[model samples]
Target: MLDSGLKTQLKAYLDMLTQPITLVASLDDSEKSQELRSMLADIAELSDKVSFDDAGSDARTPSFDIVRNGTDVRVTFAGIPGGHEFNSLVLALLQVGGHPSKTAQDVIAQIQDLDGEFLFETYFSLSCQNCPDVVQALNLMSVINPRIKHVAIDGAVFPQEVEARQVMAVPTVFLNGQPFAQGRMSLEQILAMVDTNASARAAEKLKDKAAFDVLVVGGGPAGAAASVYAARKGINTGVVAERFGGQVLDTMAIENFISVPYTEGPKLAAALEQHAKEYDVDIINVQKAEKLIPATTPGGLIEVQLASGASLKAKTVILSTGARWRSMNVPGETEYRNKGVAYCPHCDGPLFKGKRVAVIGGGNSGVEAAIDLAGLVAHVTLIEFDNKLRADAVLQAKLRSMPNVTILTSALTTEVHGDGSKVNGLSYKDRTTDQIHRLELEGIFVQIGLVPNTEWLKDTIALSPRGEIEVNARGETSVPGVFAAGDATTVPYKQIVIAMGEGAKAALSAFDYLIRQVPVDATAAA
Candidate 1:
């Protein structure tokens, strides 16, 4: 099932097993089951501590469980965990084999302290870049606490389950047979949702932290860069983010980052976090900033209030909150999200296979989604509000060449139509004729653009008309000792490399501002 090169790599990883483990598979006379058997056989042959067993009794065929020897710890995979989920499978094996996780010690303790039983089922697609995080997180929790059982199911392999559950998006999680969440979620985010007192505990911990010399908001490319730069100066640097990767976690292909020929968003985000950790930066995750309180006096500390009711004080604050997907804001759009509406094509495209769908934009992301969907879905209708497509000429040409794609320019999406359970169609208006048309579609992929995550900063700092934080050439905001950078700022061409550069510049500017601040006593003496 695995190639020679893959076998070699798997063997190297299998050597990390510190304890004996068994692969218990439930199989039937099917091609997928045979393939899974071969893969399990290959895996068992690679390590002395690993063994395979076919005496499994799971009702779900072509599924397997990674069980630690003589322990209740077990994690299940409901399909051939290839592609993006391959890493998830590897991590499960290692964790169950007594290999330590890189998760923070506090988080591990929280998982261990959880009291209730949690049966989690995550529906995922193989091509989804976002599914691995959700899968690996739950698997880790399951390994840590025997009461928390999790099974990562491949939606492609279990089409009937996907349809019955109305799961049209990747990484759709169900806890105790009820819908829990429907997007990319971090381990901390999931724990916060389940553990009722997690926020209060986190808030108390954060309130006791010492003030930082440089504090960065957000955890995308820009915030990561700023944290690293500030910490390298031997100052007390800290980063507070709702989620460390931010919008970068939702992204897929990233080809334009210079020096690096090609990489994915999640991978780069991990690298950024690792790089920052190499310094003295204090990283805080899954904590949203709710308000910005400027310093009361010159050279005073700036306070950032978090949604968790905790406040952090810093001498200098760098706002790099980044951006999120721009929703259509049309009727039923929000109501049907993850039911028939999704933002990521690479992640959720497979769930709509052989069904008619529509791409709601004409930009690069829209056209690219349409092009990609044309291969999976029965038909793709690309709707654009402008008279002409704004996508690059190359992408437009490629989209036009697809026989299953239909381009509709000068069209505005009016509303999404659903049957309460799922989406069935949508209505759009023709700009020239003022006529509205409805298309029968099983899914709608929104790819318009991004909006800065600076809504909380309004009236606190200068912001552009589009809600982006306004910054000068030095990356300093209108308020002294508060700088801004990245997609949330007024920087043009919001690219990752540009964000990193801007973040670095903002850190330097903040340092300069700190040193130049004359002491109150010194000014009085003068």
Candidate 2:
């Protein structure tokens, strides 16, 4: 099941096991079960402390559990944990074998103290770039506290279970047999959901924190750059983000980042967080900013209010709160989200395998999504609101070459159609013909564009007509000590490289503003 090279690498990782562990598997005579058994055998041969055993049950065939010896700590995998989930399987084995985790001590303590029996089941696809984070986090939590049991189920492997649950998106997690969440979630985010008083406790801790010299409000490529640059200057730098990787975490492939030939979004995001941590930067994850308050006096502290009822004070604030996927605001769109409407083809495409689906929009993202979906789905209908395709010529040519794709130009999506449980079709109107048509499909992938995450700052600062933060060449906004960068600002092209450059520029501009400061009137600073 594993190549010789892979076996050698697996052996090295298994050698780090501090205690005996067992691979308990439930199997049938199916081909996948045979493959899984072979893989388990290969793994058991690599380490003396590792062993394989039969689960002695006929439920969820081809599934296995990594259990620590002489303890109840274990995590279950209900299918072949390959592709993106390979890392998750490896981490589960190591963690279940008593290998130390790099999670914060406080977070670990919280996980260990959680009460009650919480059963979590996550439906995932191997092609999903976001599924591993959810799977790995739950696996680690299950290993930490046996009462919190988790099973990572491969939706592609069990089609009946996927249909039964009406799971149209990847990484859809169910808690205690009820829908908990349906997207990429961090460990901290999961804790906040299950633990009742987690937000209040966090708010109390954040309220008592000291002020910072340069406090970054986002944790994307731009925010990471600003934090590193500020921390290198021997200043108190801190970063607060809903997630450390922002929109970059959802991106599948990134080839345009300079000097890097090719890299996935999650990998690059992890590297960015690690680089920032190397300096004196303090990162606070899973925190959302609700409001921004400018300093009442020049050279005074600027305050940022969070949704958790905590406020952070800083000398200068850099707003790099990035953009998010734009949604089609038609009827039934919100009601059927995650039920049949999805924005990420890379993450949710496999769930619609062999089913008919529609790709909304005609730009690069839409065309690319159609091209990718054509391989997994039975047929793809591409809808566009323009008279012609706006995608690159190469992409257009490739998309046109696909035999199962149908393109509709000058068409506007009007409403999503669902059968109370999941999407069944959609309605669109042709601009040239003045005719409305309904197309039968099982899923809808909306890839129109991005909307800047600047709604919270609408009344606090000067913004452009399109709702983007207005800034000068030096990244200075209307407010003297408040600056903005990345896609949230009025910057032209929204690219990763450009965002990094803009972030570094904003950090330097903030530092320069701090040095050349005068105790002028608050009105002057404004």
TM-score of each: 0.83, 0.83
Per-residue alpha-carbon lDDT of candidate 2 for residues 1-526, written as tens digits (9 for 90 to 100): 9999999999999999999999999999999999999999999999999999976473899899888888999899999999989999999999999999999999999999899999999998776777899999999999998899999999878999999998867789999999999878889999999998889999999988999988999999999999998888888999999999888887666766789967877899999999999996989888999999999877899999999999899999999998887989898786567668887786678889999999998999899999999999999999999999999999999999999999999999999998755799999999999899999999999989778898999899999887889999999999979988898999987788999999999999988888777645754766
Q: Write candidate 1's Cα lDDT for 1-526 as tens digits.
A: 8889998998898898899999999999999999999999999998999999998999998999999999999999999999989999999999999999988898999999999999999998787677898999999999999899999999888888988999866779999999999878889999999999999999999989999999999999999999988888889999999888777776665656777866777888889989999996899988999999999888889999999999999999999999877999998786577678887786678778999999999988899899999999999999999999999999999999999999999999999998755789999999999999999999999999779999898889999898999998999899999999899988887677888999999999988888899976887788
Q: Judged by lDDT against the true structure, how good is candidate 2?
A: 0.91
What TM-score, to 2 decimals, does candidate 1 have? 0.83
Q: Where does model 2 exceed 4 Å of error?
A: 329-410, 413-447, 519-526
Model 1: per-residue Cα lDDT at residue 91: 96
lDDT accuracy of residue 106 in candidate 2? 100
Query: Against the true structure, what is every candidate's RMSD?
Result: 6.1, 6.2
